[model samples]
Target: MSVLVYTENWDGRFKKLSNELVSYGSKLAEMLNTSTTVLSIGKVDEAELKSLGKYGADKIITVTDEKLATLDNRAYTAVIAQVVEKEKSGIVLLSNNNTGKAIAPRLSVKLKAGIASGITAVPEKTSPFTAAKKVFSGKAFAKFVIKTDIKILTLAQNSYEIVEKTGQAAIESFSPSVSNDLIRTKVINVEKQTGKVLLTDAEIVVSGGRGMKSPDNWGKIEELADLLGGATACSRPVSDEGWRPHEEHTGQTGKIIAPNLYIAFGISGAIQHLAGVSSSKFIVAVNTDKDAPIFEAADYGIVGDALQVLPKFVDAVKELKSL
Candidate 1:
């Protein structure tokens, strides 16, 4: 049996998590004493696909269908399921991102494989294939054992480290049995925020909340994020109040992120908000209320008015950069 990784691409390039998946799958393949293969969709540079060899992929199968360039969940799942069948992959690894969430369940059903989502660690035991994952909105951890012959796992972002190994991946073209009828939706046009880091892929995130008082005060938040070379985020209320876009919102009802560093300004750390960012490696909270719930969760906390403190913090960062 072989270990297969689904490496996702955006705008013809691989994201950081894609490399992590490859490396993770490679390590698992080594443990299983099998080869590791990667399946990529859409238009990606052949050279880049081959470079994944350094991450432990023995082979790279690419489907460069013009129609498959945009994400169509059904079509993508069908393609992946076909690859799993053809490769006889015992373990399938995917990133627990938007695409993985949308297509993983369908692929599991099609392949008749047991599936686990939001897995945070490598399999502890290979015989029963036990994996650790978060449950109850990150409040608890659970270990799952898959009994199926073939297993599918969607890994949480930043949960696994990327390790490089020496190897050259043999690239090949794979033509799956894709039908036009399987494509249920069409993406006519796409609008994306330009020149900013995507929250899911960012290492550092600076978030603001209702305590910012008004959208007019968001300049400092943006400036701080820019100065720190990070992305800007907000709590649910900030987006509801039109102070920030919904894409930037993070909470139980919003996007879940696990960045390396998450900084909060004027946020009270409601449980719902914590559910989204609780997995961050480090948290720094700045709020005027000393007893704010965020402080309990933060590694470092500043009890002061965010408006006055933000400028000073920005100046300090600038001074440090100059030195």
Candidate 2:
């Protein structure tokens, strides 16, 4: 038996979360005394497929079909299910993203496997199996045990540290018996977001809130993000005020992100927003209000005005890079 990792692609390249999942799944495979294989259903670049090796994928099983390019849940699920059946993978791992969230439940139903979503930690080998996960929207943690023949786990985004190994990963191409009728969805238009780092996949994130004073000062936010080699994020009010796009908003009602370093400028850290990024490895808050809730969640807190604090923080980052 082997561990199967579902590799996700965006614009012919594997997403960063996919690499993290591969690393996690590979470690799980080692723990279970098995190998790890990645399943990709699309026209991914061969070079990209091979790059999975560095992140801990033993083999990349790619079904390079035109129909599988755009994610048709039925078509993609059928292909993955076929691979799992043929390979007899004991454990299947998926990244807890929009795509993974959509497909994991369906796959679990079909496989009749015990499914765990929002899993943050590796399963502790007790008697059956216990997976650690966040519950009640990061308010609490729970250990869920699955007592099934086959198990499926969806890892939390940016929760696990990505492990890298030396040597090249092997690539294996397979042809699946794909049916045209299985393809229920068609891509009408693909509107790609133009940026280097997707917020969900970003390692560092610089976020702003209503305390920025006005939307005109967003250039500072963008500058800081650029200086730090990360992406810009905003709070719900900032997005509601049209200061930034809705895609950049991070809150319980918006996009949830758990970046490694989440630097917030002028944010109060409302529970709604904290629910989205409470899992960040390190948080640095730059708010003028000493009583701001953001400071409570921050590993490091600077009780200063955002307008003054942001420029200084940017200058400090630049100075450090020069040295």
Candidate 3:
């Protein structure tokens, strides 16, 4: 049985997260002495599907249907379960995002497989498969063991590095029986977030909290993000105050992000907020309080008012860029 990785596409395109899943699945397949196969749903183009081979996908199977455009948990689970059985997938991988959270458990139950959600590392053994994951709202870690015939894992975002091993992928299409009755949800409208970097896909993120004091004082946050080619995010309070959109909210109660470099301004670092961003590779915090909880988690800290410090940072970066 080959390793199966479900690659989620966005408007017929793949992102770094998709490449990451394929890479993780590929390495896991090598550990298991098997091949890695990718399953793509939705309307992805042929060339885009083939490009997955660069990330170590040996074979690609695609399913395209208009009814499958919008996510219906039941229909998606059925589709994945059918693929797992047909391909005899010894292991299945998916991203631990909203989509994965929606259906991973159902897929496990349908296929009678053991599932480990939010797995952060690859297992070293196959006999009594073990996986590492975060627990207690990122306050601690735990190792979970899965004992079953087949193993299904939902990988946490940005946990694995993307590696490129280019090879021509064998492409083929699969037609799963997705009848009308299976789809319980219907898409009435779609509001696309365009013209800016998708926060989840951004490697670097600049975030603001309530310390800025006013929504009108957000120019430097946006300026810093633009200069660094990163996306902008805010704490829950900023969103709740209507200073920013809810989509930009990052915290345990909102979107959980793990960017390579996370720069925070004026944030007090509440436990809920820390739970979401604790996984970031590097955190730089600028807060007025030296004792702010964010300082404990930050790789680098500056005890200064963000309102006074942001303009200096912006100018320094601009000067550096001119060099």
Best by TM-score: 1
Per-prediction TM-score to the true structure, in the order listed = 0.97, 0.93, 0.96
Q: Sorted by lDDT, highest first, which candidate order results? A: 3, 1, 2
Worst 10 residues of 3 by lDDT: 119-128
lDDT of 3 by residue, 71-159 (tens): 99999999988898899999999999888888888889988888889988888577788887888778888887898888889998888
Q: On residues 75-97, what C-alpha lDDT tens digit does candidate 1 reach at each position? A: 99889988888999999999899
| CA lDDT, candidate 3, residue 124 | 57
Sorted by TM-score (best first), the order is 1, 3, 2
Q: Whole-model lDDT for model 1 versus the true structure? A: 0.90
lDDT digits (tens) for residues 1-323 of candidate 2: 89999977877887668878988998898788889999987778888888898888888898888777788888777888899998899889998899898899889888999898989878887358788887777878888988888888999888787798985778888888899988878889977758667788788999999989999888988998888789989999999989899999998888888888999999999999999889888999999899989999999999998999888888898899983
The CA lDDT at 25 in model 1 is 92
Q: What is the C-alpha RMSD of each candidate to the true structure, in Å?
A: 1.2, 1.9, 1.4
Off by more than 4 A, model 1:
none
Provide the clash count, candidate 1.
0
> Which structure is stronger by TM-score: 1 or 3?
1
